[model samples]
Target: MTTMTTRTVAYPADGLTMVGHLALPAGTDRRPAVLLGPEGMGLSDVERRRADALAELGYVALAFDLHGGRYLSDPEEMLARCVPLLSDPDRMRGIGHAALDVLRAEPRTDPDRIAAVGYGTGGAIGLELGRDGVNLRAIGTVNATITGRPGEAARIRCPVWAGVGSEDPIMSPAQRNAFTAEMQAAGVDWRLTVYGGALHAFHHPPVDHPTVPGVGHHPQHARRAWRDVVDLLAECLPVTEDQSEVQGRLLTEPR
Candidate 1:
């Protein structure tokens, strides 16, 4: 059985109230926690599914909200709400910082193993935490940008894995290459995975089933990317019970 909790956090200092879905491993063991930030479309079903999947991996994952529960169907409306934050840069940093603080404060989370992951705009926010020198174990981001480049480059204290689509027009390959150069120069333990033939948000593979729109999902790539993420977590966070079983099977079963 999995443990799931729904909670809301109010950052009065920032005038942002966020709703989060916290999922934990079964039983009383305090698990490593992950904070998930959603894309410009807000916290959607795909994100929740990802969070649940993280729980299945035996971590407490909090899919935190960034839009204050205000979602927009029209692209313009979504931009209307998001553009301000994107423009200022500091707003996203503050939003991510507040949510991270709240997630770590939870009793069921292992504060030392806490990490952050995000999609699209949310991924950028996750990177901001790295730039803020939050001392997380690892960070995962998909289809996001690297703004304030060298300025924030020195702040990342964790391994960063960035999943990108080779075909994504928004965050182009040239940009990724440039960003990689910056990351390398800064001595960041980072991996930039460019999925061949994939498009933006390609991890939203289930989006085709009457689910969220504009979320491009790729099953094979999604699984691969998730495995990569899980591997990163295993390295950075404390191990879990299920992971022990899996390792046992691998060594004893002899392939």
Candidate 2:
């Protein structure tokens, strides 16, 4: 395995002290960075692991927080917070911008070469960042096909790729159509992948805590969605030659 470093970072957003996980690849050279977002339940080990994996791939990754460092395992509590936040694009943008600031401030991050990849609520935040005119290389989201306000999507300057479960009740077919229509009307480069026979949050692993209805995990689709996100990064925010060579050596070196 590639050597990397991980640390917990605390930043303020949404009137709360947000605690996030920052993962840095091995080496001193600055590299491309990704602002990673977590599901509505908030930042968990799953997102932290994703950030670490991104670092392993030679990208600086920060898994941002949503709930002031608290993981909401209760369905009701999660909805109580996420539902209103999702409906408010400004709030979502605030959260996204705060996390972006943290990511960009890192010396290891190449500010000009940054992407945003988020899941569920986090995915919505990434879209909001795009709509708010953040200069991102790309935006890749899973289970967050959210439509922005009137004519707002025109502000998005980069390509967007979204993945959702075909049977996701939270982001239904109608919602997907609306989101795509907005993107099309705004002349944004966008793509959507629907995982057939899957439900909402299908990209997430099964949690031990109670979840809302219509949320289930599909292992096959989860891996596929992850690959799709990685491909998006590879195309839009590729690592430099030095980092790639280091990664190659790490892969071939004997354990």
Candidate 3:
């Protein structure tokens, strides 16, 4: 196993003290990095583990905060917080950029090689960063098929990969169509995956607390979607020998 390190990082964004989890691969050499965004619930263990997993693959990964360190178990509270944040593009970009700055500030991060992978609300924020013209190597999102202003989307310079549950009422078929159309009209390199029989937040593991209606977990598709995200990062942000070895191990490891 590759040796790695983890820590909590606090930063300011939108007048909130955002707390992010940072994972660093073991080495002196600079490595490619990823800015991970979590679902609307906030920066939970799931996103933290994902950051650690990415670090084990030799990438510096930071799982950013969405609700300033609070995890909302109440569906109504989650929506109440997220619905408004999602409506404001600038707020989303502010949050993402703050985390991006933190990622880039790490000594192990290769400033030029970075990507964004997010789930649910975090996914939408990642897209916002891309639309804001952040120089990301790639953008991968799950359960967030939110559309953006075409004028801003046209500024995106990276490829986008989005995964959504086909039965997700929140991200309905019409929403997906609108999102795809915007991406297409903007001349972006984009792809969409619809997991059959899954619902909103299908990529997440089962939660202890009750979730909102239309939200459920699909373990099989969740693993597959994560694999696709790994593929995207590998294709766009090539790592060094040490990292590549770990990456090989990660790819072949049994679930």
**Clash totals for all models, in order?**
2, 0, 0
The residue-by-residue lDDT of candidate 1 on 83-199, one tens digit each, is: 787665677788888888877887878888888888887888888888878878888888885654466777899999999887887778788888788888888998988988777
lDDT of 2: 0.94
TM-score of each candidate structure, all chains considered together: 0.85, 0.94, 0.93
Candidate 3 lDDT over residue span 158-192, tens digit each: 99999999999999999999999999999999999
Off by over 4 Å in 1: 1-14, 205-215, 241-255
Clashing residue pairs in candidate 2 (N, C-alpha, C atoms within 3 angstroms): none
Output the better candidate (1/3) by TM-score. 3
Order of candidates by TM-score, top first? 2, 3, 1
* Candidate no. 1 TM-score: 0.85
lDDT string, candidate 2, 1-255, tens digits: 548999999999999999999999999999999999999999999999999999999899999999999999999999999999999999999999999999999999999999999999999999999999999999999999999899999999999999999999999999999999999999999999999999999988999989999999999999999999987887778797665565567557597
Which numbered prediction scores highest in TM-score against the true structure? Answer: 2
